[model samples]
Target chain A: EAGVTQFPSHSVIEKGQTVTLRCDPISGHDNLYWYRRVMGKEIKFLLHFVKESKQDESGMPNNRFLAERTGGTYSTLKVQPAELEDSGVYFCASSPIDTYGYTFGSGTRLTVV
Target chain B: GIQVEQSPPDLILQEGANSTLRCNFSDSVNNLQWFHQNPWGQLINLFYIPSGTKQNGRLSATTVATERYSLLYISSSQTTDSGVYFCAVNFNKFYFGSGTKLNVKP
Candidate 1:
């Protein structure tokens, strides 16, 4: 089985630009999560999805950030008008229904200049 | 929100040496995991031990949920073991510790 996959391994954009990061979870996983880590900071949760429904999004930083899981298969995190503070690594993970352990993707390194 | 702290924020070891890293959380957690982040920024799940002990080859981890702490043991370490080890705990959402950065010299 393939591991969780994230696209655009690295992204560079100017402040106020829009950027979208994508994640493909392993087949048959029911839970998906998004996390972010700024430079010199611990990784922080962003949101979670259970199938097509958002289980929790309390960690979303602000209105500028949006996440979607379509058909409960893949997820996309979009940062509109990205800010310099948004520069960091974004990770996506998925877990099976019966397990608490998760499979994480190779993160997308975003640099907002 | 729970607080997670990792000890020995940085470590340097010689290949074939052994080392132990510690993680302490402030509250009870429903899930606890250890992950290794390679230099390329890939997080590899090492253990999903919420309690008890587990071993995989040269790496082992033990979590004492009642004590709100966990330990990761690396035996006969290799240069490939050089990376950042992170401990994450979940209450509702996951919270990660500041990782322990390990450098193993060959």
Candidate 2:
């Protein structure tokens, strides 16, 4: 089975620009999660989706960040007017029915200059 | 929110050596996991050991829920084992510690 897959692998954008990172989870998985890691920091959870519903989003830093799971298969995380601090690696993971283990994507390294 | 702390923030070991990493959490958790983040930033799930012991090859993990702590052991370490190991706890939400950075010099 294919593991979680993410698009762009890496992204570079200027300040105040908009960037979107995408994640395609493992097939037949019902739980999808978003996470981010800033430079020299630990990876942190951003949000979670159970199918098409947002299960949790408390980890989101601010309103500038938005996430969507269309049809509960692929997810998109959009950062508007990106700031320098927004640079980091964003990861997506998936599990089946609150499954204990998560299969993670390689991550997208976003660089906001 | 849960407070997760990992011991020996940085560890260096020669190839073929053995090491142990510890994680202490502040509260009870229903879900506790260990993950290894490779240099390329891929988060690989090592173990989802909420309690008890589990072994996979040279890696094994044990979580004592009553003590609010978990342990990860790497035996016969190799250069490929170099990375950041993270322990995360789910107390309503998932919280991760800064992680233990392991360097296995070949």
Candidate 3:
């Protein structure tokens, strides 16, 4: 089966620009998560989705960031007027409910200049 | 928020050598996992060891939930083992350690 897939493996945008990162979770997985890792830092949770509903979004950093999971199949994280501090790797992961392990994507590297 | 710390921060090993990485957490957790991010930035799940011990091939992990600490052991390390190893703990949300950067020389 295909693993969690993330598009635009690398993205570069000017400061104050907008960018959207996409993720396709593995089929039949109800739990999807978004995590980000700044340069030389630990990965931090952004939010989570259970099917089409937002399970928990407490980790979202600020109002400039938005996430959506349509049909509970794919997810998109959009950052408007992204700041230079937003440069980092964004990873998407998915797991079946009650499962022990999570499958992660290759990650998208975003650079804000 | 919970605190997660990993040491020694960095590791250097020779091929065929063995090394151990450690992670310490500040709170009780329901999930503990180890992940290896290769040079290509692919996060691969190595183990989901919330407690006790588990072994897979040349890698093994042990998590003592009571002590809030975990250990990952790599035996007969190869050049391919050079990357970053991260330990993540989840209570409600996941918290990750800074990761141990490993460099294995051939």
* Alpha-carbon local distance difference test for all models: 0.94, 0.91, 0.94
Fraction of the true interface contacts (Cα pairs closer than 8 Å across chains) found in each model: 0.83, 0.69, 0.74
Q: Which ten residues in a row have the lowest lDDT in candidate 1 chain A?
A: A95-104
TM-score of model number 3, chain B: 0.99
Q: Write the per-residue lDDT of candidate 2 for residues B70-101, one digit (tens) a residue.
A: 99999999999999999988765568999999
Prediction 3 global C-alpha lDDT: 0.94
What stretches of model 1 exceed 4 Å from their correct place?
none
**lDDT (Cα, tens digit) per residue for candidate 3, span A16-106:** 9999999999999999999999876999999999998999999899999999999999999999989999999999999997875788899
Residue B81's lDDT in candidate 3: 95
Docking level for model 3: medium
Question: Which candidate do you rate higher for TM-score, 1 or 2?
Answer: 1
Report the TM-score measured on chain A for model 2: 0.98
The deviation in Å at residue B56 for candidate 1 is 1.2
lDDT of 3 at A56: 95
- lDDT, residue A13, model 1: 99
The order of the candidates by DockQ, greatest first, is 1, 3, 2
